[model samples]
Target: MFKRILSGLLLAAAVHGLTITKPASADSKLHEADVKWQTVVNNGDLMPTAACQADAANCRTFNSYNQPSLNAKKRVVFRARSKGGKGGEPVHGVYTKDMSQAGPIVRVLDRDTEVPQPNNLSAVFIEPPSFPRIDSVTDMIATRGNHKPVWEYTLADGSDTKVGTTGIYTNPFGPLITGASKLGAVNEFAFFEVPEFPGTPFDVFPGSPAVTQGSTIVFKGNYTVNQIGKTGVYYRDLKNQSLMGAAGGGEKAAVLIANNTHTLIPGTQTVFGSTAPPSAAKRQAVFAGFDNEENPSLGGIYLAQLKPYPISKQPMLKTLVSIGSQVPEEPKDTRFNRLGEGVSFDGRYVAFWGAWGDENKIVRLYCPKEGNKDRSAYCMSAASGSSQDAVGWYQDKSVPINQGLFLHDINTGETVRIARTVTDFSDFVYWNFSGRSPGAGEGEEGDEDGEFARWRSASFLAVSSQIKRSKDDTPYQVAFKARTGALDTNNTYQNPVDGIYLKNRSEKSPFATLIQTGMDGTAFDPKAVFVDEDTGVSVVLPVTEMGLERDGFRNGRLAINASMGTEEAGWAGIYLGEFR
Candidate 1:
């Protein structure tokens, strides 16, 4: 598994000039290869910022960190947001950094911490609204707790646990069969009162919670029960910490795999009108639903398998890539019109995010000159303006989107298309705010407090079908993040190269830009120091954002969240890389 976790590590040869800086920069052949680049916490790096409890903002450092994850002993964990906190309320945390230790970045929960359980019922944490999951082999973290459910912890015995809960779960561990009362009310981490529909509770938990390597806890439960609402996809084994689903507690704590009443729609009998939110490995799980709900393009991408527990029947789903089918290299029948709730499983490779035809292309949406109504003043006077003047003047004409990046080999069904959007990418997806939706407020398009507009996209494909290359066994390997297009320069769409790539189907070299972003920031932190935080002058910047998620890859290591190309304020943070 992952090469026996690096069985006797000491292997390097795959170096191909990509300069982490020292002269070397003609794009360092596209920047970075033998790897080894570490800096897991940047943006000035001081620490402990999150205020709201009062008195804690001398204006520290770190103000952003993204999804991150990684395990197999390189331990990374992420989801941050700090930077000077005088109780103006934006601390938010979930840190952990130990790329094999020199230590110090720890905090597994913040926003004021404190949520031990319902016992004294004091409840504390109010900020982890998503993205946090570690445990590739027990680094244990699984998050989701803006105020009440899915949590796991145990970063060396800080021991948290509330594996999945919501409304009424009195079983802090006491009775079940014989007499039922240490104070009763069992259903162990009940996830909003689910006990096979007894009184009905599932009020909402629409995804973000998938921690497998034996600690199980895959989730996606939803609302309404007697009034009907439906929507499901669950699993809760918490590896012996409790809620193993029903033996002595006899109330069915979790196990429901797929529910839109009864799960169908594999090839297409239809039924599940809503699913998404899943991604487990080795014990199987992989999702993205919609069975019509009046045509969500028909929806696809399945796979279930998962058996164990007192459960029986119902689990074998399979599908893989659906929405109308066909779509392989495209141009003949070109099917798959769309499919992306997210999927990135690595049990045997899945990495999804598809789209096939008809969105009418035409994207020219660049920006970097806030304030002063200038429509790029004639492409910034035919490219003579330079100073980071990216203004391209919004031309999305209200709607038209396209995306691609696929790879599915469940063994051999084969799918492969890794990167697209005008071909090889002009952005394979990135959205902290894309307008008209997410939380849109000001002129009121959306995304302010409605949160969730942040995206690195396509669930951040990180595939690994056993990562072989054992000299040509070449099974697979992938890592992604795009923005390149115009056929990689020569056709130049202006600024068309922002990377983080690596592809190795045994490497004939179709991909390997290990993180290029306008090049030279010490090739990516040799000693870094790219000022201009306000013309303190010495500038270089480059990296305009890069985050990767599918747990940010493992064993060969990857964890990133770059950013630099600043509006000012200490570049940006978190980096790791490794892979030799």
Candidate 2:
């Protein structure tokens, strides 16, 4: 699951030119990690004075691109905004850092670059596994305003050697699903490839799906007639252009959830296909129903199991979670919206918003625990005054729901108040204070019985978990961090550049906002530091003199957006910082 660190003096004592050692405590070995923040691309770096109209005043870099990508080599790639635009054009150039030690910027494409479709050039995502196979210009998925986006890796290389396009989807009823009908009603390609995990075997499968017959594309096909439309999760085999799910604008297929795939997994080949039963170890998707109907046909969540490659059949859909099963978990007949499902890496569990209202409530183990009477507790109220840590010697007074991230287990229906959040949330931000068993593949937290079980926000980056204690031979509430939107303003806390947190589980509540900020003794507060709870090993990121901001964490890298300041002061720029 994650790498581990040792508890000992980082540096061995050298007494009189002789190496010496001493037995030290765990805290004694804790240290900080380096956070190297570099301004990957700024107006000063890219939109230089020469690029402007002879420095006729302030020539700011108009940056429409905020999401930056980092490959295995740590090379940065992002879209840059142009000074001017023509027609419906949006993004400027696809750029990357020069591989040299003093990495310079390199523009891959200009604002007026020719595209296959009438799309507003948005952002480029590097397919790391596909990058090396090709040339300097990596293989990537370029998403724009259009439904039929061009994922042409050959085009991304900037060699002027055109290869392919996602030819607009053809509809059997009238004509085709073009980019023009985007009235919240268009068949749009949402994601191109499966998301990458640290240990996942593959990232992207570079292919000529037309000739090779192996390309896979997931899209949201919306069917509209007289202001009425039905959208559903669509699967397309890029080779022959076959379809799955309700792409034909079928009756009842009203909406398709974009982010229904599991964390770090893109799920299956077919959205609805016939495949052999999947083992629990394999990756599967727990998505909201495809057809919006009252019947159980498309009720709560359906599991899409993957089939072997060259599979052109529709995926086998099983009711992973049913709306009927979920209705009982609601607050005593309180009407609620059908929550989308959040699948755990382990196929057995699914998390979702149990109930939403004044209180961001959750329901876990609605039925009963592994060994318990029927109609037991639905929520974690019993643990309300107790510590979930196995040996629960202390009672946690209460955790407010205003800024908390809760998880609802669909299987056992046991509720765990994972995080009492504070600050805000950042995307793709992840941290491992004390890591897991060596080479373990996402084993359940507290799987070691007395060991702590790690729980995390299924949708966001906020995280919480149990703690293993050595003395008691049982796990305890050690520490947890919740991403929040606001903090105790009465406490006079500064706004966090990165809105994630880490708090000790022992404290009744979070005392201060646990993020690194305003310590550089400068006006530009760009330092985004992540402090590990157990070791106190802080990863301090580099803060440029100019104001810097980030939208969210992309995996482990911080892509600098607008923190606080103008473009001339380095607002519209691309900054990349690795949290080692």
Candidate 3:
């Protein structure tokens, strides 16, 4: 399907000549190959810079306007002239260097330029692929006989030197360089082709060459010729290293690879593979739903149960709940309906909650098993018509209810109000608060105002402001830990920066706070909250504005946001924290 879509798009463009400026066949060929010589140059845009004039005084030009560095040294030094007035310039030039021959200095004319002429001259480096913001510059050195001339540069500390020469030489990845040279005194510059790996192409997707638990692996393979009909996800086992499961019909769909102990619903499209769970209790779980139509509808979440005996047999899938629909008696005053959903640590309960249009409408539901007939749903609201949202779970027993907190007993199907009504929760405002039952273990400690401190055995909570005070309205973030009701209402933590917030387990003074300010338009948002079971240290994973929207430490190494860079949409990644 991907190939067909790409082919159709390309064929339509070819037939209609849809582009505004059509290039010659030769130019098209060059563009396809990224060939530099075939690029059309606009004479009006060409202006000589100081580096092009050979005068150091004139070269005080802004580095942006200088000929781009094509080598590693990042030194910009090259000039070229063309016969045709509007013709493109050749990216090569000659330079003179004095070398030590015995004790005497010898002035030698050299071809120090290392640009990939004609083939890659049209290439522009907005940022080095590996190093962002660093520009590669152009430089030339002397050629010795048939061998490319080598240029030497001293390190920044001046204690070490590195040498690079012109002519084709294999680079760090074994790419043959058509031309090359050294840049400045500290940088190494070279232009080389991307080498094709031999043998079974090293699978870039399944980076480790084997499938394992907790790995978001990608399977990549190359064919000498393109296969038209064969496409979809295929898997191989680590022990046998043999093809196991194959799901067809969709492009870019994900296979939730889990052990055999996991369950699935019946009649759902899924591919089964042979792999025993770590224990007799564990099963592999995979998410395999595809919507191909342009306006295809979203399917509800499904639970699949895997059987160990027949590895090729499809798993059993049980429909849990639909995200597209709202509860039947949902209040109309609330702008949004559903809040958030997650499974319990024991995977025995799937909990969900959301705010109705009105402040008085708060609903919570629990699905205990795949198709339990006795399961039921419930709603909770504040008497003052205050809005509510669920944050997360406190322990295996209680789940965090927004606006007002509630305690529930899963075994008895009973719930009891744990805290007083949150009076200050408004649309634009948020209040930070923490609460715990009287006999809970030592709470995670933190500062009183939720600024900083560690709680020993408590839980922390934060709330946003309801009102918009100014154009740059500072979002109020308050935190507190208490044994019963809300924390100190007067000392709410407020900051214009969105990232920083406070956490506490009990109403007692907080031990520490988490705060982060945006730099250069980058802001962070806290994602997950973790309270140390032993030390009372509260850890959080916050989403940064950079590459990984969600990042946090757990144990020590960072965990990837499974939703990141995957076909699954709208899933924010999860981050774990380290002990230290």
Candidate 4:
């Protein structure tokens, strides 16, 4: 319980209408702690031009980076692009750095790298997906490889060969297609087939795959059989070395956690219409599912056990929260309106995003068309003229969103509200650069695929069971990224300050702002600096963008994909902040 003095001071601050209130104690270690920051990579640094010939288009300096994933070993893996490579275009690939080793960034796999076996041997990788994940305990990385499909066929004698036209190519793998059939197979692929449902190979791995300790990989598999498409969340253990190829090996076959067809929507009479990618820790996984495939309005986050693969019955899903359930901390009649696609589970606790009530607002981004050659100048000028939104000629279609962050204790079945829109948070469904980059154009394009949009609600919450402050009482901690709301304030940015925050199960304040948009870059890096290209003026830029996902937060350290206001493109890179 908070002391009476602290409560009075906070009430006074609230009466004064201050957005943020700090603990007024000279020796208050409970409220906040110092964070040790380390830089991972930034733009303008010589990008590792591996696999590409030395004489290739000077594929030297990095241009941009996507959200990064950090593992327990202090290893960081992310997707980055370097322009002027080979064809005067951007060269992209998955790159990693072992912070424990303090070594240079190493290219794990790139566009120029060959697509491994089970696919066309001669084919090279196309654009690798964003947010490649690292295992909690190993160096293995799981990413979707985009490449030409390797067709398979059954000959007259009923033997399968690489000659059919099914073209089921793009799949997620651990860079190397095969490895020892044991835990921590860093070289094996995440390939699997359901024996009961043959002919429907896992053709596509949607979103980034989640790899738990011991190398158990969980991912959403999209496949079709007899022209009927179905999607499900499945997991495969790499311990069985013999089940390497596309067929099942009895108990070694991939276990289906949940799917659209047979998986029932808890507390409802309907079956699941679709399921989202899962977040796994140990042998347990948690994910979101909807009851309607096309326009889902029901369903919630679910938990599934992953061990004892050859079970006698289907795995039972434990519902964390659902549509008809009462919203936590709200009026009795307030029910959940929608759940997000992203969820984080670490066996004990589940962190997720939920929206309720009818109060909604339109989140609009300046999204210009990509192929509008004739209207490019007009669009550019219109975009440049607006400082409120991204530079673009037209605003992207507005999204009516009302979302919040929540944490549910699996042990107690208690759902606690972390923050809500217009109160604790300004926005949860939309995010953007604090300021534009000189060469970084549109924040998002109108025609761009919404699957990878930075503004999705899925980017809001990330939970880790390892950040518990006290072993006696505290259970877990969660890190959430959002634009500042009524409860947060930054001196530098008059607009809602974007930040990544930390909250525990037993925090007096709702959360502690670990890092935010307007903080000094030096806190993250000692040598961090920014120079104006035109006047050669140099200054320390403030923090801008921060990574928003579970992979960014693990153990007690947070992997941040932050930027220092765009004054220097190189200022934008990955950083690690460890709370002490």
Best by lDDT: 4
**Tens digits of lDDT, candidate 1, 257-314:** 7878767777666678888778887788888888653347676888887776667455
Q: Where does model 3 exceed 4 Å of error?
A: 1-236, 240-282, 286-298, 306-310, 325-515, 519-580
Candidate 4 wrongly placed segments (more than 4 Å): 1-33, 51-59, 151-175, 178-196, 240-252, 293-297, 310-313, 368-402, 431-457, 468-472, 485-494, 532-536, 567-570
Tens-place lDDT digits, model 2, residues 358-446: 44322121212321111122112343222244422222211123332333343555434433322323111222111122222221111
- Determine which window of 10 residues in candidate 4 has minimal summed lDDT: 178-187
Put down candidate 4 lDDT per residue, 287-375, tens digits, no spaces: 98998733467888888887654462457888888877888888898888777787866667788877776665544444344432323
Q: Of the pair 2 and 4, which is ahead by TM-score?
A: 4
Q: Rate the local accuracy (lDDT) of all candidates.
A: 0.57, 0.29, 0.22, 0.61
lDDT score, candidate 4: 0.61
Please give the clash total of every predicted structure, in order. Answer: 11, 24, 96, 5
Model with the higher lDDT, candidate 3 or 4 = 4
